[model samples]
Target: MVGNNHIRSVKNVRVKGIACAVPAHVAEVTSLTDAFGAENLNKIRSSTGVERRHVVSSECSSDLCVAAAERLISDLNIDRSTIDTLIFVSQTHDFTLPATACILQERLNLPMHAAAFDIALGCSGYTYGLWVAGSLLSGGGSQRALLLVGDTISKIVSPADRSVAALFGDAGSATILEHDPSAPDMPFVMGTDGRGAKNLIVPSGGFRDRHGQSTETSEPGVRGPYDLYMNGAEIFAFTLARVPALVKALHEANTASGKEIDHYVFHQANRFMLEHLVKRMKLPPEKVVLDVKDVGNTSCASIPLALSLHQNKAGSHLSGRFMLAGFGVGYSWAGCIADFDNVWVSSLTVTSNSETEGEM
Candidate 1:
């Protein structure tokens, strides 16, 4: 059932506006030394390169996503009624039954004809979201689509587990996809490995193991069944074993079609692994984008967050032909190359409202 080579090509769809929103609270990595020994803290910081992360106390993923989408719509002056599709990608949804996309449709005030749904995914979600949104708009009926991606991972990771607590952060990002015949053809490659699902997962709370009993112990550094469990070593090994080859395959396909990638953006997982990937692929470090230092790993929001945060930095490639990759979580990964010609890339917007009242 795992498709390791699923390539998709979509036409007449172009990325329009990009925006990101993060919680106001700052959680510095050094502050965690008190909770998790100083030695362990330093080792993590050195390897992860996460100096700070934005975490929310009471805010939910829906709140952050709505904030980001509203800003993107307003900043771009987009006609709300014209949008015909809305897709929300996240693992942390508001409810188990009603899809968060339906809630967003009402909150965003889209037209009655608009179709909305949710995609439950994590780190690899942004690229997948882009592909889905673009494909939906390319169907000739829907002219515009909104992709909202993020996760309030802080709410899932056990506060006692330093592994996840020190690495994960919360962020919501918005990307607009519109129909444009003149736009470049977007080429994509996606894959999945179900065998590694347990390597990074929350084992309980789902119907798979109902009973509601505690599956994890109170080990100081270890996580329990109710907490986020990540086998860092396995993840690193998978990243090294899979990501480079995935990038190479996608690059060859894009280049073969006469496309020149001016920049590259990979999922902001961490520093050590990213550096190793770059070296293994033998790609020039200057072309690769890395912005995880300040925001930590924002899951699906990492790519869009990096695009929004580093737009002003020198050599930042928010335009031209760019290769984008998102990996991890569900043991899934996806890559694509697209042109941002005539697209409006917005600056990063930080919102601190923290209001979870279901309205802005």
Candidate 2:
């Protein structure tokens, strides 16, 4: 059931570079002790493994993504005119009318001929973006693609809500995928179940519930209809039931091709959940990346952000057969086994606006 019609393989596409950026503002989880009490805050911190996270005051997800894209374009010395495809993936877009990708294309100085569009997704968006971009390139229409993924979940979460406020952060990333004749094929497995839609969603703000918005606390100190509501138990159960199968299908497909995965970089959902997955799958702990201590679950930006952070911390480039999986937020899950050969991953950049503030 996991691999019948959901598996896809794209060839002649290679990732050229990746860059990530976060806001300059930092929010400590323990600073909420007055709202949730010391014991509750401690419990949340220990379980989620989130000590602090970067947040945005006036900046949106697009701002952070533009900062990252600017850095990536500069670092790789990529010609702006050569990028013919622009894919911006996120749940929080700049506007509901004009696509944010169009604005990004103009801001990044990409050619007007570039095909720009937006993908409304979260958590599994990075892998999904890669799939779409790779397909576009491999199909012969596009030669180079720029995929931007990010989310500012903090803007949606109620500050007083302990369930989500302490578990989410803001981040953005840009990844370049170009056509390469000698690059190995990238196999991907993706699945989705809309039954778990309400389990993690904003109850209002869309067309279905446009007039149902409310800022009043729905529960005592909890979120409202317009805010993000996550049924944690349901999400955990869904991940347990779905993600393992997704990973299994990806592994089987890769192994059939006589290739082994060198690293596992899953969506940095949380510390406890990632640790549990690693143990249950019997994967090598050293090969898996579990770095959610500083930046909390960043939705779509998590995967690319993790790769950039890992490469910077190791003080070297990432070159290997990498297995990247992203699961959550839509009850959507995707995993890909790709060969990364000296992929250019820039160091983590922190920004307040257009200029780099510092590194976190």
Candidate 3:
């Protein structure tokens, strides 16, 4: 269940193509008027260093996934029929009935024989999805798989819920992974704490509550209409308690590879969480890639989107190893710091004629 290494070994599978999509509706944080106000926006801006964010309009998570996947498949010039499997990971799903992967498979015109399904994960979903696809390829379970992640928080979010709205943006990313002989099982370290599940979640609007009418309520406390809720303090405590240990483990993985991790691309949660982790880990500021400028916190898409954009922008400096870590929602989290010195990611650019949320 492994390939040697993307960097340490000469036989790493290259990340041939990557594509990301965001909805048409975009507004800078400064666009927030008296509702959020420039003051609140400035505070978030100061903390997250984000200027703008994207939102999905009249679209569900599956719609964005379908659209994004189509764009990715076309742009990469991949024969959709060749995708042996489709793996989608996201906390926000399409409908409760059908798996979003199957829905996307139909949308992409891939062969029905090409297995498709979904993984219910949060921010770390992108990293977890890669490792899942990689393991399948290595174990001879599937040849090449498409991994897609998208969020529709723009619709789910209660405008009154300032906490989540200020940070999250809606987007999806797709990666095309093919089998390579020498790559190792991308060092996977994942965990969960059911005890903290309630810290970040939508308390209603599920099978559990489909019949149970949501009790009317308002915020400053538990509110109804049951929007995405988060106890920022609890989440911080949970992440602070968990991620550093994983960071240390990542360091160990890098040391054994004869190469220090040159960069760390963690989830684009927020700046407070990021700064705290960076200082505690003693990692260089440059090593912590901050791709959270315009897109804010894009949930499952954050890490891959970060990788997609940073690798595109960094150009020749893209070599060297980097750590990928994501923590949030599900009270579940995961980390994978791989040796990718030999990996070359094709830069993804969204053009005016492209099939992105805006252009389309």
Candidate 4:
């Protein structure tokens, strides 16, 4: 028997560093007006609060993750060999056969003894990654781990699909977690509802559906099963239904543990959905971090990217207790409370074609 409301805690796991990378290309919302119509595009901009997004054509999500990990390792002066675990979380992996984590471990030059794997999660990934990595670090001996997460969602999403075109972008992030007995305990709550999986998914290209055999390709406005498809209305309703409850539950748990949240970093789904969640939960607007305007939704990278971008502007670490909630795709969601005091936060890095290499 499994529980829907799962709670876990890990002690003495400190976030040592966080770095994010995105494609150099910027696509402004106004630029899409010619295709989506000026009036309709305006409405989208107003609703999603996205003005521009970083996109990549030739690059894969692994490329972005490798760039971010390299920057983090270089900036923090961390010994690559000490990283005992590497977790790569994303939906847009470089290949379907070998796990992207294995490729990343090699590209990043981790020790052969290091553990590596991939997690197929989208928006809820960062918080989940943090939990998984932190838990592994909490044990004795394995002192450090790299949790890399992101997605090149722009490639999978159809350019002609108005529902998700301007809503997503490409980016990757790396978070360094290490053992620190003095660090505060991190608490989290995670839940999933598979009933809503169909509301947002890429119906093909997987073993379950396979590729080049979808029936929806001929349908009006359908971009075949290989392309990303989203039922925005259903996702919106699902968020409205799940996010507030998750927030409230997590908030109560935090309160019970005598932890007062100093900031809320919800997944950068869109401005409208985030604002609604904040309002519904009666959380203070000042405490909520809404930095998605320029980056759009970078899937798993959004939360960490938001933190990185904020620190880049403020020129300081994200101090105090912060509540993070990520909900979307997988119909999966996770919420957590952690303190990032003195954590090394890097400014956003732009991806280049030369950064990607052919072999490890």
TM-score of 1: 0.93
Distance from true location, Cα of 174 in model 4, Å: 0.4
Candidate 2 ranges beyond 4 A from true positions: 1-5, 213-217
TM-score of 3: 0.87
Query: How high is the lDDT of residue 227 in model 3?
Result: 77
Cα-based lDDT at residue 37, candidate 1 = 90
Q: How many backbone clashes can be found in candidate 2?
A: 0
Q: Give the Cα-based TM-score of candidate 4 against the true structure.
A: 0.95
lDDT of 3 by residue, 13-37 (tens): 4344566666666767766656677
Note the residue pairs that clash in candidate 2. none
Cα error of candidate 1 at position 83, Å: 0.8
Question: Per-residue alpha-carbon lDDT of model 1 for 25-117, expressed as tens digits?
Answer: 889989888788999999999999999998988878888888888878887899999888999999999888799999999998999899999
Candidate 2 CA-lDDT value: 0.89
Better of 3 and 4 by TM-score: 4
lDDT of 1 at 74: 87
Instruction: Report every candidate's CA lDDT.
Output: 0.84, 0.89, 0.72, 0.85
Q: 149 in model 2: Cα distance from truth in Å?
A: 0.3
Model 3 bad stretches (over 4 Å): 1-14, 211-223, 316-318, 341-360
For model 2, how does the per-residue alpha-carbon lDDT over 220-333 read when each residue is reduced to its tens digit?
Answer: 557778889888999999999888888888888877777678899999999889999999999999999988888999999999999988899776467999999999878898
Q: Candidate 2: minimum summed lDDT over ten consecutive residues — where?
A: 212-221
